[model samples]
Target: MTGSIVFDPLIPWPAIAALAVLALAGVVLALWRGLSGWALRGLAALVLLGALAGPAYQVEDRTPLTDIVVMLEDESASQALSDRPDQMTEAAEALAVEIGARANTELRRVTVPDGAGDAGTELMTALTAALAEEPRARIAGIIALSDGQVHDIERAPDLPAPMHLLLTGREDDWDRRLIVRNAPAFAIIGEPVTLTLRIEDSGAVPATGATAPLEISVDGGEAQSFDVPIGQDIDLPLTLPHGGRNVIQFTVPEAEGELTDRNNTALIQMNGVRDRLRVLLVSGEPHPGGRTWRNLLKSDSSVDLVHFTILRPPEKQDGVPVGELSLIAFPTRELFLEKIDDFDLIIFDRYKRRGILPAIYLDNVANYVDKGGAVLIAAGPDFASADSIYRSPLARILPAEPSARVIEDKYRPSVTDLGERHPVTSDLGDGETWGSWLRQIDVTAGAGSVLMSGVEDRPLLILDRVEEGRVALLASDHAWLWNRGYEGGGPQLELLRRLAHWMMKEPELEEEALWAEATGQTMRIIRRSLSEEIGPVTVMRPDGVTLEIELEEVSPGRFEALYDGPEIGLYRLAEGEHEAVIGLGPAAPREFEQTIATGEVLDPVLATMRGGVVRLEDGLPDLRDVREGRPAAGRGWIGLTPRDAYETRDVTQSPLLPAWLVLLLASVLIVGGWLREGRR
Candidate 1:
């Protein structure tokens, strides 16, 4: 119970102040004039004002509630290393028991976990949230059981009571972490990209050698080791071996006496893009389909096109001089022989053997395709003739052989059964109606799956692989009808784009591939194949745990599965012969970035509240009651501020004097003052 004086005046406070000032002035003037009644007059004025300014006794009936002690337990990944988890558990349980047994005290245990993605441990975030639940005035102190490697210290809230951080690691704790300070997200294939990295050592530095053994590997292959200097930035130059997502893993051999080897390894995922795609377009003569190919290739700013049209054959004998017929001859030697390997893709549009390119040049083109190059053939009615290029050496790699027959009937193209499961032709089945073609060469499908067929189920489009390169054959030259938007048109642009990218070996357009991409903690697994159904995918986690998950057919050629990542590390995905590796969070997760514990982060905050910083490894400290603004810590014990806060169940206030008593006092004082002044 507590009591205080409270005011409930009959008049406003401003008016009362003014009236008191006037009464004081009049008494001072009377005293200075040698008036004998000044003392009585002053006493009378004070009495009258006191009656008007009502004073009451306010009493509060409070039931003392328990003081709150917040115990923040760090359950983040770093805390689980070595014996820290056990240490924290032991200390927390002991603290809970001790706090619960204390008189008028309560314990609030808040478990702090890893933040979203690479945000690390948010100890202050947990503390703020815990504070919000309990009354600020009632919080006696905040006790946290953590490694003290908090990431968001700036978010610490304004604490009302002492905050004590009980450290959770030993003095001998040490750790090593690999940091990738700078890396490009997209790097051009075949071009060297520089990555900046450093090896950071925390806690007690071991007496190891100056140089550490670092290893580098691409796409989960065998690693190559090198000696790199510790505690210094090193620029690593790397060239992507292929297009699309390239997973590069870098690791350093774990040292003895370190906390854990989790930070010694890091995963880097970067995209391999093309600086410029070189395409060679050879046209037998000016035709509408040739224009369509030109337009499609030119649409992409990344493509560098080198087109050549054979306007006149060498065999044609015109009665004109060579200089009059042409100003510059086509550089066949420069393009087809010397720099053939420089091109990524080569297209022959309705081209036949016109003696424009020698037989040796044709052989070189076939060899080019054999040595990891792309080629496409668009045959016309002339392909079935005697002078067809199919009779040349290039026929060895072409997928289809044209018979001596030409189908001149109007036919609409349709995707084959196998095409439905191939990425290049998979999306062609968006249910859009394609225009009709008037001319198509009758061909016999030899090697490769027929993706599309024209009239009477004959092969229209066939794709195959020759050596290390890719080949595609289209049996019609009137595909430009779709580009002209005839009969509502079809996905001519889209189909052509897919075919071109597939020939270039784009990973997304591959018919068979296994890949995984992660967002937050969930990984989207994609499996593409030409088979009707894909088998189960074998997933290898960073902890060497293998999981077999069955994939569901999301579309014709695509199978998808969403798996929540168990932790942040490199995840390996394998489906039969296809394999892929993806990094989940950062190379070294934020939780593992700093594993050693210290009190340098929150020491200032603890000092501001006059709190203690103790280590659980030394044993849970004894809790003691201390006054606010005093040192709440000793050598083997910590202290808490006993707020003695409670809820006021009842409140009563009464005027010190009753209304009649106040009136009687005021009348006597005024009468006494008037009679004394009249005598003076």
Candidate 2:
């Protein structure tokens, strides 16, 4: 219990001072006149002044709170690496037991986890939260059990008590990591894309050879190995093979004496697209469809179309000299032999061998189509004549042969039975009200799938895949009349565009293929088919675990499912042999790459607090009472703060005496004494 005095007053001090002065005057007059009751009069005046000044005692009771101890534990991803998880688990348990055992103190345990993305462990944020829960005056000290790495140090709260850290890790631990810095998200196909990467050493890297073998692979193909120097950034240039998403995996063979291999391998997913598609359009004769092909190819920003038209054939000189004609010669040799390979696609629109293109030039064109080149042929009436280009060396690659019979019946070109499911023409169904072609071709045989049919259901459009190349043949050249609003042509532009893309070896045209569309990190995996249903989808996570999920029919002949990834890393989905990579998170989390727990990461700041100490081996220290500014340990640690408080039950208060009676008696006495003293 504790005691203290408090004051309460009624009358002002000025009234009391006036009463004292009157009593002093009476005393002086009585002394001179020798009055009998002089002392009693003075005593009465003093009592009156004291009574006007009322006073009372005020009291209160309080119990001061005890100081609090804060224990912060790092529970981030990095702390979970190596044996750090176990180490932290043990140290936290020991520290809790010690602080709990202390007297006059309360222990507050705080757990901090790794922040999102590059933000590592938010230790300071955790500390601030713990501090807010306790009283500032009652806070004694703070203890942290974590690796030294803290992401939010700038946000650390101003702690009332001294803060200390108990780090967890061995001194000899070391790590090596591969870092990919400036990797492009999208790279052009067949063009070398440069990626900046570095192999870095941390902690106790060995003093062995500096160069290591780095094996890099794309889309899980056989990797190529290279010797790269450690601790320096290197530019790696790689040319992608196909378009769409590509996964590049780089790994270094783990060194024998290396500390950890978690950082040895890294995966980067980049998208591939073509810079431009070069196409050569060889028009045999001027026709309405010839302009349609040129317009469609020229419309795209990424397509470079080179169109050649033979306006006047060499045989059409008709008694006029060849030099006199205005038509320029078609450079067949320069186009077919010289720069044939440079073009991605070669189109022959109603082209025929009318002594204009020799058999040798036509043979060279066939070779071009055989050697991994795209070829498209839009045939006209000349296909039935002896001048048909199909009769030349190109006849072997053509899917259909001319029957020498012209079928001149108006028929609505419709997709074939198999074409209804084919990627090139599947979306276009019969009875779609498409324009009718004025002319039709009579074809006897074709090696490719019949995509479109003419009069009496004859094959009008056929698509085929040859050795390392692709071919599409449109038997009728008059199809372009539909584009001129002849008979309400339905999606003429779309049909021709898809036909061209199909001949370019687009992956979407593959009969059996697996592909996925990305929505952020989640993927909508789709398996398209002409069949009734797709079998099943098998997904492979970055951790090598595979999941087989049944797909649901979302639309006609299209199966789809959503796959949500658990982490931000590369994931693969495969249906049979079809697979694609889904990148969920950043290629690397800049922070928390090193997961070892160490006190060195947290010890420097802890040492700044004089009263703080780390006793990991000894467990939590015993609580004891110590003077302010003294060592935190030595005697038992105090658990509760001592509060000296007391309570008062009753209070007595009153005025000293009556003021009117004292004033009247003092005035009469002073006047009578003064008269007697003056006569004397």
Candidate 3:
């Protein structure tokens, strides 16, 4: 309760003051003339003036409210490292007991978790939210139990009293991190692409050499290690081995006494693209179907086609001079032996064994296929004759053997059961309604899968793998009839494109493959195979936990499953002999980017609030009372200010003097003065 004096004047204050002045002057004149009633007159005038000035006593009844102290507990991912979590838990319990013991104080504990996505630690965001919930006038102070690695420090709220930080880590904590400063999303295959990287050490790092051993791997292959200088930018030039998504991982061995190995490794995924595709098209003679093959390869701007046509063989006797023959000599030796490996795919369009290319050159072509080269055979009726190329050394790599017979009946190509599962022909429109072909060479598939058949179910197309290379045989010369819109043109363009890419070993066209696509933390695992039945996929998480996930066949031979990963890191997937590695989120989470604890991030705000930092490793500080605007942290103790906030419950006011009593006192004094003057 509190009390104070207040006034409510019965008349204007100026009028009362004027009457008092005139009465005081009359009394002074009477006293100067030796009047006996001068004192009594002064007493009467004072009494009348006091009645005009209304005076009252006012009192208030108030209830003391508790002061709010906001305590933010940092529970982010980084805080889980080492012994920081234990330290935080202990400090929180101690602070809670101390705040409860203090008079008129309450604790608002806010547990801050890891931020959404890659936002990292959001201590300030949580603090600001907690502060907004309580009254600013009753706030005593703010405290945070953290590693000082806050991500949203700019959002720190305005402090009503003081703010103190209880740091969680030891002074000797340190960490090493691998940083990929610059990397390209797409790099041209077989060309050197430069990537920028740096290795750094933070916190109280020990004395060590200036270089560290770094290991690098592509597509999860065997890693190669090299000594690299620390704290300097490194430009690494790499040439991708295949055209597709290439996963490159860089890791450094964990050093002794380091905080974590999470930031010591980085994963980079880049797409490998081809600058241009080199193709060699060899035609035996000028024919209608030959132009179709030429046009198909020429349509793509990325394909460089080198076409050669044997207009006249060595056996053809011509009576024309070499200069006037309008024929350039074919560079058979340069193309077949010198630069054969330079071509991505070699097409034989109705090409038969001729004296133009010797038997040794054909033998070299077979060797090229054994060493990761690709070949396509588009046969004509000549493939069944004595001059067929199947009779030469090239027959060793061919997928099918010619039977010296040609079917002249018109037949529409049909996809076999195997073809329906093959990537090249699986999604090509319904094969039953395609245009018919005029003729096909009879052949027996020896060591390959027959994808398509025609004319009494004989093999029409066969694909095979020979050593490290791939080969395809389409035993028909009249496919050009379909391209000419006969019987409503078929999917000639799409079929040929898929066939070519498959022969060149495109990753997406592989017979067996395992990969994953990620949208946020959810991953879609895909498995592609030609077999009718497949085993369950075995998934290995980032923390070495393994689980088997059964896949559902969404389409013919394509299996898939969706998994929502609990953590962000590299994931390893395998089904049978096929395996793949993919990253669900960032290679290095933001929490691990700065593992060592320090108060620099929140120092500026703490200083403005007249607070200081206390390391928990030095022992949890004892809580104490401090004056507002004074330092709230010291060597062995932290402090919270006393708010002394209160709420008014009731108010009362009473007049100090009654009006009747004042009038009676004035009349008595006036009469006494009059009687004294009459006696004088």
Candidate 4:
């Protein structure tokens, strides 16, 4: 309850000012004429003005609002290190108790957890949200208990009152971080690429260890170790061993007295791309399909196509000398014996032996495939003849054996039951209205997967792995009809491209493989196999926890499971003999980027509000109220502003003097002044 003098004016302020001037002029005239009535007249005028002013004693029924103090507790990943969580909890509870016990004060406790992906500690973001939910006038102070490793400082709200930071973690806390300053997303195969990195030590460094052991691993292989100097940048020159994604993990052994070793490891994902894809395309006899292969390889800017057409065979006997015949003799010796390994893929299209390539040269091709090389055989009718290339030494790697029969029936190609799961032909368009093929070399399917079949269910396409290498066989030569838009064409381009890439050992089309991809906290686990159904996948989390999840069939031979990752680190997935390693978030998450706790970032913010930055290590500071812009903190103490906000429920107003009393005073003064003037 409060009482004060207030006015409900009976006359307008402008009117009152005019009346006062006339009264003052009258009194001054009377005084100048030496009349005693001047004093009496002035007193009467004062009473009249007072009555018109409507003065009244007002009493208000007020309810004081409780001042709200927000105590935001940081529970992010960084705060969970060592004993920081315990320290934060203690400080937060103390803050709550202090604020609650204070007269007419309330505590709004807010717990902040880790943010999504690399968002790190969103302390300010959480504070802003809490402030929005409460009244600004009721906010007396904001107190945050954290490790002071905040990531979203720019989002700090405009403090309506004093703000203080009670820092967590001990003064002796230390950490070692592995930093990757620069890493490319793609690198040329066999060419050395430069990667920039460094090692950093924060807080208290180990006295005995000046350097740390660093391990570098690529594609889950054996790791190579080297001692890396602390606080120094390193430029490492390395060559990629294979094509496709190469996941390189760099880790520094944790030193003694470190806060956490999470930041001591970094994962870099880079793609290994060939400078150029060298391909050797040999065509024995010219046909319409020959142009298809030429146009396909030539269209790709990355592929180097070396095409050769044998215009004349040894038994042709055209009565022409070898020198007069054609474009220089086929460099068989240079191609087969000298530099055979230079090419990435070797395609023999409609090739017939006909004594063109000797037995020794064919043996070299087989050996090449045995040494991690790729070969593709596009067989024509000649494949079923006595002069077929199947009669050569290279036949050992062929996925299909010739049956000496050539079928001349019209049949549209269709994907086999097993092809429904194979990546190459699984999603290929239905062949209901596809074009028909005229000729197909009949053969017995060998130890390989049949991706495409023709009339009577004969193998049309076969893919197999030949000891350290890959091989593919296509039985029909009339697939170019699909390219010519016969019966509305088909997915010939896609089919051929996948077949070529699969033979080249593309990782995506591997028959038996496990891999995972991450988007934020969720990971998509993909398992590719030839089996009908796969068992549950066993996932080994970065925190050494194992989880088993069942997979559902998404496509032919492709099984997938969606799992949510709880932490930011590398996850290992295994099913049978297949295993995969995937990093869910950044190589070094933002939470662990600066593990050592300090008050440097928030000190300026606290100073703006005249609040102190106190470390909870010594002790939880005492809470008190201080004037705005004054020192808000002192030794062992913090401060909150006293808002003294209130709500008024009632108001009353009444004239100080009645209208009749003012009239009587004015009448008596008028009578006395008239008498005095009359006497003068």
Candidate 5:
């Protein structure tokens, strides 16, 4: 309880001022004239004015509230890195007991955990939330237990009391982490991309000197080790071996006394895209479709297409001598054998065997296909001729044999049941109003799967995989006419693109493949196939648990399912046909949430005013009054600095007196006194 005196004015200040002025004038007149009666009247007037200004004694009952001490405990990933978790747990329990025993003081314990992946710690955020529920005036101090690595320092609340930090880790604790300063999301397959990477030393580093040997690998191949400078980003020029997604793993040798190896390695996945895909186009004769094929391949900024057209047959040469017939000599051996490996893909548009290209060169082309090379054959009616390219040494590699019979009729092309499920030709269309292809060559039974068919359901396109290579045969040369909008056209560009990319062993088009994309702790698992149906998919989690999920058809040939992971780790997804593994969480949980842990991170203003320092180690300090701007405790002691504060429940106010009332009263008094003097 508390008490105080207060004022309750009956008149305004202006009226009181006027009364005082008149009373003073009366006294002055008495003194000037030496009149004792005037002095006596002035004294009485002063007492009358005093009664008009009212005053009263006021008091209120009050009780002091107990001080609230916030004990912020960080159980985040960083705190768990070393023995900090155990230290924090022990320290928090002891502090809570000490604060509870203190007179007029209470303890509020706040526990903070790691946020999502690599977001760091959210200690201050938790503290701010705790502050809003408690009385600000009763706050004594805030003490935080953490690893001093907080992520959300900007959200630190204005604390109402002194804040102190108890850092968790030992003085000798150290860590080695892989730091990637600048990593590109995409790189050219053969061109080197520079990666800025370094080994960072923090806390206590082992006595292995400043330099460390780090191993680097791409696409899970043989790893190469290189000596890297510590604490500085070193430029690493890496050339990708193949196209599509490439995973680059960087690892450092674990120091003998290092705390954990989680930070010793890092994985970076980048897509390997060719700067320009080199392609060789061999055209046998001139046709409207020939120009179409050239334009389609040339339009892609990423494709380098070299096209050659044979305008004159060997027998139709001019009367000039053989040497003078044409200055351009065909370099069959050089293009088909010597430099064949340089090109990523080779396309033959309506091309047939001619006297210019000997059977030996054709054999070289066949060997190229068998040795991981890509070949696309766009057959025309000439494929059925006796001099067809299929009749030469290339016949062994051809997916289909040509029959001399030709069918002339209008037929809409459609994907076969198997073709509809093949990634290359699937999802083309339902053949309602699609653009029409005018011509298609007759092909006999082929070893590969038939992707598309024409009238009477004859094979129109066939795709095959031979040895380590891939091959595709498009039976229609007139397909290009559709690109010219002969009828209602479709996505000709997209169709041809998928076809070309599929033949190049692009991972996305693999017949049987498993892959996944992650969103938070959930993963979307996808299985692509050329088969009509896929068996159940089995997923292996990092915890050695295997789960089977049924895939639903999302597209003509694509199947997918979703998996929510219970923990952060690597997960393997596999269908009956293919298998793939993906890591969802961080290799090691560093600081989760906003990682920085400061007493102010909880309530900034309150912490500053309370003279508290956020310590992640010592936990909550015993509430004690310490001097400002000095060590919180002497030597190894941990203490809280006092905050000077006062609280008042009652407040009183006064008002000015009315001037008219004061003047009227003074006039009456002066007139009455003069009347008495006249009567006497």
Candidate 6:
């Protein structure tokens, strides 16, 4: 209980001051005149003033509240590495015992786990939240048992007391990590993209060679090894093999005595995009379907089209001169012989041998197809004639041969059984109610798979692989009828687009492929194949664990399976000859980025509060009591400020002087002063 004197004035303070001033002046005048009752009169006046000035003794009853000490225990994944987990556990138990032994002290244990997803150690975030729950005045100190590699240091709260760190991990701990400094999210195919990387060693690194052996693999293929200098940035130039997502894995062989090999490997997933698609369109004559092919290629801004319509053949004996009829001469030599490789794809729209392009030029075109080139043939009535381009040297590479028969009948196109499994024609929509084609040339498919059929199951579309190139033949010119919305248009644009991209070697449209997509730790593994049944996919995890997962057919050709990966790193998938590599989460998780224990990150915050760091590996320091606003840590001990906080239970107040007692005393003093003056 505590008591203090307080006042409750009956009148205003100004009035009380005026009465006191009057009493003083009267006393002084009486004393100057030699009045005998001046002292008594002054006493009587002081008594009356004291009665009007209300004063009381106030007392309070309080209960002492315990001081709260927040102890943040780091339970992140990094703490589990090495012997840090045991260190953290031992330190926490010792601190709890010490806090409980202190008089009027309480311990608050806050366990901090790994952050959601890729978010690393959130030590400061947990500390801030723990402080917000308790009264600031009642907090004694804060202690964190961690590896001191905090990811959310910016979220540190203002400390009411001191914050000390009990660092885990030994002083001799060291690690080597692979860091990807600069990697583009999307790179153009066939263009050299430079990626910057660094190999860094932290802590007490052993004496080793300056160069480390680094291995790089693309799409789970064979890795190429190189000796790269450590502690320096490396600019690696690479050209993607195919379009779409490309997974590249980089790794360094684990060295002896390193903390872990998790940080020694990194995965980079970049998308391969085409800069531009160059197409050469050679039309035999101006026809209704010729514009369909031209418009389709012209609509895409990425496609660069070189279109030539063979108007006024050399055999036509017109009266007008060739110069008067044509604006410019066709440079067949420049297109077919000189820069044939510059174009990615060449289309023959009803093109025939009209003595325009010589047999040598046609032979060069066939040679172009043999060297990783794509050719699409859209045939019409002229394809069956003796003047057909198939009669030339190009016949060696074409997928189909003309049967010299053109069936003029209404028939809807249908996907063949093999086409149902091919990515190009699979999932095109329901083929039963498609629009009818007016005519289809009879052809014998000899080298390629028939993707579509019409007019009594005759081969209408064929695709083949010729050495390093691809060839596709569409045996009708009536595809424009679908574009014109005949009996409700079919997937004309989609069909042509897929067909063109497939020939150009789009990775997503490959018939035999394997890949994976990640959503958090769950991976959706996909396998595309032409065969009806395929073997189970072999998945090799980052930790060298192998799992064989059987994929179920989700669609006609697409097989998929979901696997929840327990770790984050590069995953290799293989099914027969098809192989793919994908990254589930971060290649190097944030926890493993800096595995060495250090207090540099928490130095600023600790200095502001007069706190220090103590390494648990050196021995847990003793806890001591310290005063507020003084140094809270020393060499052998850490200190906690004693917060003498209390809660008020009750309050009482009593007047110092009663009104009746004051009045009686004033009357006695007045009468005594009158008698003394009368006597004088």
Best by lDDT: 6
Give the lDDT ranking, best first: 6, 3, 1, 4, 5, 2
RMSD over all Cα atoms, model 5: 4.4
Give one digit per residue, the lDDT tens place, for model 1 in 189-258.
Answer: 9999999989888888878877898999998889999999999999999999989999999998889989
Tens-place lDDT per residue, model 6, 526-563, is 99888889999999997899999999999888999999
lDDT of 3: 0.90
Q: In model 4, what is the error at residue 266, expressed in angstroms?
A: 1.5
Error of 1 at 486 (Å): 2.4
Query: Candidate 5: global Cα-lDDT?
Result: 0.74
* Candidate 3 ranges with C-alpha deviation above 4 Å: 1-64, 312-320, 403-412, 430-439, 478-488, 518-522, 541-545, 564-571, 624-631, 644-680
C-alpha lDDT values of all predictions: 0.88, 0.73, 0.90, 0.86, 0.74, 0.92
Q: Please give, for residues 447-540, the per-residue lDDT of candidate 3 as tens digits.
A: 8888889899999989999999888999998888889999987888788889899988888998789999988789999998889999999999
Per-prediction TM-score to the true structure, in the order listed: 0.93, 0.77, 0.82, 0.93, 0.86, 0.88
Clashing pairs counted in every model:
0, 26, 0, 2, 58, 0
The reply for model 4, stretches above 4 Å from the true place, is: 9-26, 33-54, 314-326, 657-672
Error of 5 at 322 (Å): 7.1
Per-residue lDDT tens digits for candidate 4, residues 1-680, read 89888876789988888899999998999889788779888888988888788877878899999999998889998888998888887777776776778999999999999886578899899999999999998898988898888888888789898888888888888888999999999999899999999999889776746677999988667899998778899999978887777788898877777888899889888889888888899998889888888888898898899997877777887688767855777798899888889988999999998787889988998999999889999999889989899999988999999999999998889998888888888777777877788889999987788989997999999998899888999998988888999878888888888888887777787878888887877999999988998999999887899989999988778889899998766788889998878877787788888988888988777888888788888888887778877888899998888889999988765556767877888889878777876786
